[model samples]
Target: MLKLVMMNDALRNGDAHLKNFGLVYDDVMRPRLSPVYDVLTTQVWFPQEVPALAMQKTDPRGTEKWLDQLELERLASLSHCHNVDIVQMQAQCREIALQSMATTLDECPKCPPRKALEHALKIIEGALPVPSSSAKT
Candidate 1:
């Protein structure tokens, strides 16, 4: 879930709030995570704006900081979170980020330049708690 929120921000420059995410329940009375929605290119409007719900560990909740290894491990230790394999998550997040950008381009013909998308990729890659070339300098 942390990865998804960060991906929405890092990959698409979105501003996901609590309202934008939720759980879905099936007819059989089981609950499952819902697909991420309400995503938008918020950076296009508020270029310097931060996400409504910032990812955090030991850090302050509202501050959007680039997560490092120990921080990610803390999250992965949670009962219902991604695995602790940071490397694997990093690669997977990159793949998802690229796919998301391509999908955006396909759906929104007026999408911004490729370089801008690439820049977002770095953010997404960096959110995996590892050193990535795309991380903000």
Candidate 2:
């Protein structure tokens, strides 16, 4: 779940509200998160758009639309995740988003959508942090 939040943030998915998530029951009747869908980089189209829901613990008023590194750590704490997990998830999400966007950009034709995707890719790559060389080792 935290990973989903990280992924959406990295990809600038502004429409990722509670309604976007679904639950499925397995054969043993245990509930599990359904595969994610309806992902969009609404931020590119609506630059002023904010996250559909606030994940910050400090934002009692839910006014914190955009999340920063500190807020991400707070969110992980609220979600009962170890701090290390959030750090790892951030790096993983960054890599996945960059790879996905690069592949899409290559296959995309030379057009406006491609332009928007290129812009989105730049935003995504810039927003998320890469793990340090020391950390990678």
Candidate 3:
């Protein structure tokens, strides 16, 4: 769920790739989702693409709104791909994700992207509980 949100932001910001992500494992040998990897691309890559979208914009606010709408669309597709409820799971995940990204960017200055993702994973871990140790055993 969190990964979908981060990926939505990444797609919105135009940073899509595996290098942007990492994974961790739990006691039950399951993989855990990481925070946001490769976010710097937004700062590094977004400006070049902006002028194209900007020209289509009749109103200044349209550009920002367009990005938000794009994010939501991507979230829906992603949710479907994962076989989850788009509105209930993805929407809620995106809301939590926005907050997670804001908090990571603010408090974790100089934190490595992997580290940031680890933090984000921790946050979502509670919301989407992992399989229990007993279940795994």
Candidate 4:
């Protein structure tokens, strides 16, 4: 669930805030994050600005909405209420989001030259864990 939300946020450049994500209970009352929806490419509009939600308890940096590696780690920790293997989480979420992002952009008329969309995907893909070396202090 955390991975999916972070992935959607990556694909949408940090627009996938708490309100943009939710869960649905099963007949047995088990909860699961709802399918990714309302993932708008706000990047084209707001560029890299404030995230829709804060990643840390009182993270002022998150207000910048850059979706950098530090924020990814913070989100990962929060996703399951503890730290999980960010590498595995990213791989899983990327697989789920890539198809949708590609399909959506592939259909866009403005996404000409093909490479343009590809370039965009690469940027979103870079929204991965901020390695310890580069992560903010």
Worst 10 residues of 2 by lDDT: 128-137
lDDT (0-100) at residue 136 of candidate 3?
Answer: 39
State TM-scores per candidate. 0.61, 0.82, 0.33, 0.58
Task: Please provide, for model 1 over 8-89, each residue's C-alpha lDDT reduced to its tens digit, 9 standing for 90 to 100.
Answer: 5445454677887789978558777798787755665555656566556576554664455666667677645755565556
lDDT tens readout by residue for model 3, 1-137: 44444334433434444554567776558887776554432423333432122212335566633234435445556457555443444445545555676677778777778564554444433333222332434
For all predictions, the C-alpha RMSD in Å is 5.5, 2.6, 12.5, 6.0
For candidate 2, write residues 8-119 as lDDT tens digits.
8888898999998888888557888899998878888987777886565456676847677778887777778874656667888888888888998888677568878988
Q: Is candidate 2 or candidate 4 better by TM-score?
A: 2
Candidate 4 Cα RMSD after full superposition onto the native fold (Å): 6.0
lDDT per model vs. reference: 0.61, 0.80, 0.46, 0.61
Error of 3 at 74 (Å): 11
Say which candidate scores most in TM-score: 2
Output the TM-score of candidate 3. Answer: 0.33
- Model 3 steric clash pairs: 35-117
For model 1, name the residue pairs that clash: none
- Compose the digit string of candidate 4's lDDT tens values, residues 77-133: 655557576655665666555676688676875756565567656656665543344
Q: What clash count goes with each model?
A: 0, 0, 1, 0
Cα lDDT of candidate 2 equals 0.80
